[model samples]
Target: MEILPRPFDAQPLDGTSTVPKHVQLRESLRSYIVRSGEPGAAIPSERLLGEYFGVARMTVRQAVDCLVAEEVLERVVGLGTFVARAKVDLHMKMTSYTEEMIRRGMVPDARVLSFEQQGASPLVARELQIEIGQPVVRFRRQLLADGEPMSVDENFIPAHRVVGILDDPPPTSLYSVLSEKYGLVMEWGEDTIEATAASPSIARLLNVEMNAPLLKIQRHAYVARAMIDYSVSYYRADRYKLWVPLQRPGVRSPRAYSSKRLG
Candidate 1:
């Protein structure tokens, strides 16, 4: 990995500036990363940065900490901080993980952690629009892309939706199985995303540090008008991002309406 060169000739932090010193330092570091650093390149030590900028070591640390939280930098215990790799952006669309990875030219895989039939709790029942304590097939799996752990998915489906799903092993993409085997096509889905901290088990599974940032996604999938499954997936925040396209309300594309309508 190429080591990022320090910007020794940069102007010192202005004392009269209203912005906090740490924020100024952070912006400088961010620019340096963009211009000079590559993924895994080591950043300058806090002590060295402090001396270079004539600031307290704590101030340097604070700036570095913010970058770490943003995943622009990562710190190894024995090694110093280094630039982070780019994250994968998942556009807001109704697609299976397998399909998405393939679209990105990545090979996708899944390891089934556990699979069982159980009585649904109130939350699961409500999400699947079934009676409380109804029979449900619970499937837990870990998703990987190019052999790197990506996310953990836990899904609950009403027992009647896909009969004999539990008889065989779970596939990497549940949607594919539902479509091919049961003829139950997932036509649409709704998702909610939030930032969260990794749990101990999640950290271990994903090979990340405990309490590291994670992206939590909750989804409800439907076939026609019937709810089919409810799922929650925890994705590594440093490795993944959610993206969506927005359009102003009351705006319509020219193709959406015929030109004859104007006449």
Candidate 2:
């Protein structure tokens, strides 16, 4: 992997240049990070960077602040600034959280927050195509990656279909268990994603500040036209991104399109 070039080695800022000093410094730092090829690597101290660049400490701070705001870097209270992890890109597909993280080379973990059989709410009933007040198994869990919180997922399944699932340990992949134990293979699903603010409880659970931006995903999974899973997940916007591929009508194949866009 390449290492970051020393700040002093960067090209000197020209006094007569049209670009602002802070912007120049920010670009330089960004280049250094890209060349370094190190995610979560600590950056040089602001004071040292200022001295190396012959700029005021405030100017150096401004440069670093820009990178932090753009999520190219992150600041830890006492640990200093470091390169931010690449956000997980979730493409439009039916997949389990475990499968998604594994594809990204990250270890996935889950902490069950709550699990119980409860009467389905009106909305849940509608989504699952079940009667309101019908018994349903509700499982709420915190999905983690590399020991860091990623999303809060709440899933509801018809209790009758998953007879004694509660008796077993919480699974890393709910879909896997559903298939292996209950012979319910989720073949297709639709997801609706929306931007939302973190509620106080959710903020605490996700380790984000209250009102932080979040991506709320509502999913309905089915097996042979039978609605089996209704899940609502809230993901930290800073750490996750959704990718959807679009094709024009009458396109014979994906390869026939010259340009595919992500939404």
lDDT of each: 0.87, 0.88
- The digit string of per-residue lDDT tens for model 2 on 1-263 reads 43444543555667788999999999988887887638878887887788778899999999999999998999977778989988988686777889888998999999999889999999999999889999999999999999999999999999999999989888779988998999999899989999999999999999988998999999999998889999999999979878777777876665555455432
lDDT by residue (44-158, candidate 1, tens digit) is: 7887788888899999999999999999998888888999987899786778899999999999998999899999999898888889999999999989998999999999989
**What TM-score would you give candidate 2 relative to the actual structure?**
0.78
User: Which residue runs of candidate 2 sit more than 4 Å off their true CA positions?
Assistant: 1-24, 35-51, 55-71, 74-82, 253-263
RMSD after CA superposition, every candidate: 6.2, 5.7
Please list all clashing residue pairs in model 1, or write none if there are none: none
- The stretch of ten residues in a row with the least summed lDDT in candidate 1 is 1-10
Q: Which candidate has the top score in lDDT?
A: 2
State the TM-score for model 1.
0.71
